[model samples]
Target: MSDIIRIQNLQKAYPGFALEGVTFSVPRGAVVGFIGENGAGKTTAIKCILGLVRPSGGGVEVFGKDAALLTAEERGRIGAVLGENCLPENLTAGQLDRVMRHIFPHWESETFASFLGRFSLPQGKKVADFSRGMHQKLALAVALSHGADVLVLDEPTAGLDPVARDEILELLYDFMQEERRSVLISSHIVTDLEKLCDYIAFIHNGKLLFFEEKDALYERYAVVHAPVEALQGLKDAVVAARRGEFGASALVRRDKLPAGTSAERAGIEEIMLYFIKGERI
Candidate 1:
């Protein structure tokens, strides 16, 4: 499948932090989860993709067009929800709808109205009166109202309760029922991504650590429980390990594991924690 979004060696530098050689792609008809800890450059990489932050080096492309060069019409095909709401607090949902109709050439009032009703958002109530979850739902409704082929969401589900998060995820799943639709969602909530994503891209300290199909990532790594001595000899295979009084548990490459050693399937959260917090053997 062709990529809807492609980021190649994208770089950005601040006074103290830098996004270093990031690269990943969101393929058509799939949800690609962008996962990392806070300060891992997930947001920066996304901003670069949206042309919000100027990259110091490298490139980003959306819909086969360079992101920086996308025309207004090309940009209309993409919808984005950043961390901030960016909507006027004094404006009611009804007023926002009117403004959006003017902004997006393909805006659908019927679709927006349906989403507001489905999400239980109040059209006449000012945005300032809505709760965080309500604001998020409104933002999502806005993003979906326009005829967008791709969604770029940064921390879209953050600060939401389980029920609300699930509702939002269900909306995304429904959006992808149209085979050409795609999404690039960045969040620290690995479990949510685990449920909705076909591919996972991990970033650490502003660098792209790995990007692979979710199933392949699980297949490539395993968590093994063995003696510390056994783990010591397999340093090359061990990504991270924890030692205790009884034994050692390590995240290791499946193929490199010793014969007869049993390894359990590793979840995305477990893998991420080990890679971020555990000691490398």
Candidate 2:
């Protein structure tokens, strides 16, 4: 598959937090999970990709064209739901749809209406009266209604219920079935991405910790829980670790694992924690 989104050497420097040397490619039809903690530069990198925030260095390409140089015509292919992505408190759900239809020439009112129907959103009810879940759904409806090939979402499921989160995940899966559609979603909800994404990239302290296929990430990383004394010898193998009085635990590459010892399969949560801990032998 060809690359649908390419972020090469992207850097956004700040007084305290900076995105340094960020690079990755999301191939068409691939769903990439942009995983990071709060203040980990996920939002900063996303803003640069959307051309909403200017970058200090590097380039962003969307659908084979530079995002920075993209004309409005070239940009319509991407749908974004960033931050709160809220509708005006005074605008009703139907009014929100109308506004979107005008803003996006390719807007699919029928499909958007169907999504509203599916989500059971009340028409003509202003956003001021809506619950947090309802507001989130409204933002999603706006993002998906335009028939965009690439969806760039940041923290879309931050405070959603399990059911609501599942619905969003299902929608993402359904969107990818079109074959030309792809998504770059950033979230701290690791399990959600583990369920929906084809690839995963981890960012921590404004630096890229790792980028790889989700399956490979699971395959190559291991969590070795051993006695405190045994942990010392294993430090040479740890990518990140924590040691104290009780005992020591570490995340190590599979190859560095001892021949006699077996490590537990690492989950996305464990991987994220280890990477952020920045423990190196």
Name the best candidate (by lDDT): 1
Please write out the lDDT profile of model 2 over residues 173-196, one tens digit for every residue: 888999888999999899999999
190 Cα displacement, candidate 1 (Å) = 0.3
Candidate 2 lDDT score relative to the true structure: 0.86
Put down candidate 1 lDDT per residue, 1-281, tens digits, no spaces.
Answer: 99999999999999889999998999999999999999999999999988999999999999998999998778888988988675778999999999998999889999999999998999999999999899998999999999999999999999899998999899999999999999999988899999999999999999998999999989999998888888888888899998878888999999888787778999998889888888977
Worst 10 residues of 2 by lDDT: 272-281
lDDT of each: 0.92, 0.86
Q: Given candidate 2, what's the lDDT at residue 215?
A: 95
For model 1, the superposed segments whose C-alpha errors exceed 4 Å read: 244-247
Candidate 2's TM-score: 0.95
